[model samples]
Target: MSSYAAVLRTPHACRAFAVGLLGRLSYGVVPLALVLAVKEGSGSYAVAGSVMALFGVSGVLLSPVRAGLVDRYGPRRALVPMAGGYAALLVVIAGVCLRGGASGVELCVLAGAAGTCTPPLGPTMRALWSELLPDRRMLETAYSLDGVCEELLFVGGPLLVGALVQYAHPATAIALGAALVLAGTVGMTGSPAVRGMGGGEQAERDGARGAWGAPWRPALVAAGVGVGLGGVDLLVIAFADGQGRPSVVPWLLAALSVGSTVGGLVNGAVRWGGSARGRLAPLAAGLAGALALAGFVPDPYLMAVALALAGLFVAPALTTAYLYADELATPGTRTRAGAWVNTAVNAGSSGSSAAVGLVLGQLPLALCFVLAGVPALGSALAVRASRGARAGVPRPESVTRVDPREPRSTAGR
Candidate 1:
């Protein structure tokens, strides 16, 4: 607990983290709100789902580009306009939905446009954390804390929407989400830490190209993790429905969240002796193994237990990936590098969910679980192979290995 306190105690750390969380909460709120609003306006689930798909696809695919802008222009300049445009689009979307006259095409166009302009708050806040905490251990704690809070916000956002929808139209929630983001972004960018940060366009372009290739390990692992976890929700519901216990689905999902939360906190508190890269593959493997065994559980209760066990590896794997991404990133490319991993995870999740839905009807349930585990296992193998590929190569005499634990200067970054 004190370790986490040490992280918050850093000057300006609390404010930046708080405002970032506030802005990011909209990410949780908007998706469900948009779906409901579009469904209400269009009178069709099909149209709503299609609109969301377009929105998510645009956001996930363009994340790195937006992050590059943040890197090239600095956060203060890049994020403010992005948030403003995004908020304005959300307002337009809410107005269209509430007025009840807009066509499906118009709603889809607005949602996609809003998604394209969606602020890269998560990636940006992570970059800010790196800048604020130069010490590697504390940074690890910060990432864990951030991950857990994010997971909770996602859980809470839906409940908040659930409450709001009882008394007000879903479009109202969309408008509220827009307001939260605009307010949070304005407050966040005004902070001294963000103000002090510089644009890295020139430095990023001048740096060696070789530095760009190294972050693939973390990004790949993150994608694999995303793929493994993405289908769990549907799979768990399927398992429960098969047993005629549909009511248990929510409890099972909550178990996964609880396990992940506990695992993330524990991961940060421990002082592990290895590079984040070295630990990442094993963490992924643990998740893959646990998920593979999930299908063998005999009942919904057992399935919940199995998933909770699997969940233990979830946050730690991702936290390690983010930490590794930071380690691999140059100061100028920090946001872009993290954004790649962010994009990979989201893309993997979206892809896997659709793919899993297609195959679930055709395959045996156990086989489906095994199939879902393959991506993470493949990622673990790729990491090992990459390491072996480099093992035989001789190190340059000019370069010396830096101790992973050493607290170095953050002069340029």
Candidate 2:
């Protein structure tokens, strides 16, 4: 905890971390909020799903480009316009939805635009850590803390959305989410800490490589990890539904998040013996064990405990994945690496969510845990097959010396 404290004791890192969190919460909440609004208005999950799907697809299409822009330009130049513009669009869409007579086609178009304009904040913030802290050990802790904050968002975002939807309105929730994201974006972009992080000559040269470089293979492996983690979330949801204890779901999920947060901090503090690449498989496999045990838990309480244990390895594994990515990525393309991580992980989550949704009605609910574990283990194999087993870079004193004033490089093509 002292190590974690030392990493965040500075004011700039605090601002970035704090505002980054607000933006992340908004991002996590919006999909479900949109679905709830659409479903309540349209009276059909299929149409609601379609609208959200369109939104997601549009975001996916633009993520790489936006990430590239941040790498080329600075975060302020790339993110401010995008975040502000996106918030305004969300406001317009919220008003339209609140007014109650918008056509599905119009809503879909708005959703698509919303997705396309969604600022690539996830990548930008993740990249900021590299430039801000620079020290390898401190960098590990920063990533760990960031990952834990994301877990917190997953836990809290839905609850906030649920409350908003239940009490005021989905439009209120949407507006609030937009406001939070925009505020966070503004705060982060305005911070000089994040703005001057573009690098010098070596970074530019490294960032000049094509997008299809070696970093992507490991990014895909990270995606598989996302699928597994996402599957766990979906399976837990299914398990709650199966047991007719829907409210218990939050407690179970909270336990999972808490465990991950604790484990991630511990992982960060320790000076682990091996390279991140070497540790990746074992950590993932350990998650697989806990997830597999979740398959047979008889009741929700036991399952909650199972989930907590399962979560223990998640952050460490993901931190290692990110560390591996940082090592493999070109100098100027850290933001793009972050973008790849975001895209890959979300892709996995989306896939697993859809898969678990389809199978919940057909198979025994317990088996969903097993099904989810398969991907966690598979991610390990993916890592190996992708030659992600290459050793991690040695920690160097030079890592502490990155200058934030250099112009960052780009590799869009």
Candidate 3:
């Protein structure tokens, strides 16, 4: 009996890990694939960048709807169909660009469609982890591990795409990307741990029927932070392009990722006794400091170091936003709540990218960096204000236990 149980557990862990890896890879590869297709088909960087912006727009528009679907059905049911649809869309787009030569408008439409079909993989996966490991400690560890997985994907996916495009055919890279998405989606859906479990349908129905309330203040603040970071990213890219060293853009971004990964790991390993509200101050302060440094730095290497320091606050702020969403969300709307947070981030990034692209040629890149930091400072101020207002309010104890197969309890208010 012990041996059988061990075997069963091993497969479950492996499947979960594989799903995590695939989810990150799919996300990281899509942008690279789009860049390649646009350069090859249209020979225009601006058009390619526009197509990428369209993808972000579609993600922002579709995330809430997709999240609601996950809440309505289960993540497993929603993910399988969406993933399959996304794979089909990718193949179509690849074929069109390769054979028929997709125009800018056509590419934008297809990219938007592809983005709309993307599954709410991150939130769904988080929900799965919550269900599988009910303990708070384990859940934090799982999220930390997911953060590491994200870094790995960003590191490896572009490298893989670059190699395939350089050595093999670009088509080969697209096909491989589609295959991985399909395989991972199927693997995830078929897993007993994900498929056999679900948050009760009745709770979701009830939650959906309720009136939509005003946006949570903390969530808005977090979205503002995302906007700042997005602007910073655009500035970095612009600076690199202006310097005739576009390749360094990835390294700068990677520095941020590396810093955030370390922060997540450290936060997960340690214990914090204060209320969620209490941590807001330090998180905001850290973000402000990072932003200040990034704005002030002169040299490229120094700028990378400043951006990395800023990144230390990024994951912590994101995790806190998730926690706040969990607190504010209605009983069955957790997935949508999380998705709203994601949508905000994407929307902010999309908006900033568009704004930056127009003035990038006119303005000094250093000024762009300074302007980007303004939003972060603004977000920190907003967070501080919100925390002050809610200082006396009692917070519900954090609930990590999630038995998706079982009905939700109505006892908590």
Q: Which regions of candidate 1 fall more than 4 Å away from where they truly are?
A: 200-214, 388-413
Which of the two candidates, 1 or 2, achieves a greater lDDT against the reference? Answer: 1
Question: Candidate 2, which segments miss by more than 4 Å at Cα?
Answer: 40-44, 199-207, 212-214, 237-247, 361-367, 385-394, 397-413
lDDT of 1 by residue, 113-148 (tens): 998998898888898887777677888998999999
Per-residue lDDT for 113-141 in model 2, tens only?
99998888777877788776656778788
Cα distance off (Å), candidate 1, residue 310: 0.9
The list of candidate 3 runs beyond 4 A from truth reads: 1-14, 43-47, 103-105, 196-199, 209-215, 237-250, 357-367, 387-413
- Each prediction's Cα lDDT score? 0.84, 0.76, 0.67
**Order the candidates by TM-score, highest first — what do you get?**
1, 2, 3
Candidate 3 global TM-score: 0.83
Sort all candidates by lDDT, best to worst.
1, 2, 3
Q: How many clashes in each candidate?
A: 0, 2, 1
Cα lDDT tens digits for candidate 3, 252-317: 988888788777667666656665445655675677667766766666798789878888887776
- C-alpha lDDT (0 to 100) for residue 241 of candidate 2: 82
The TM-score measured for candidate 2 stands at: 0.89
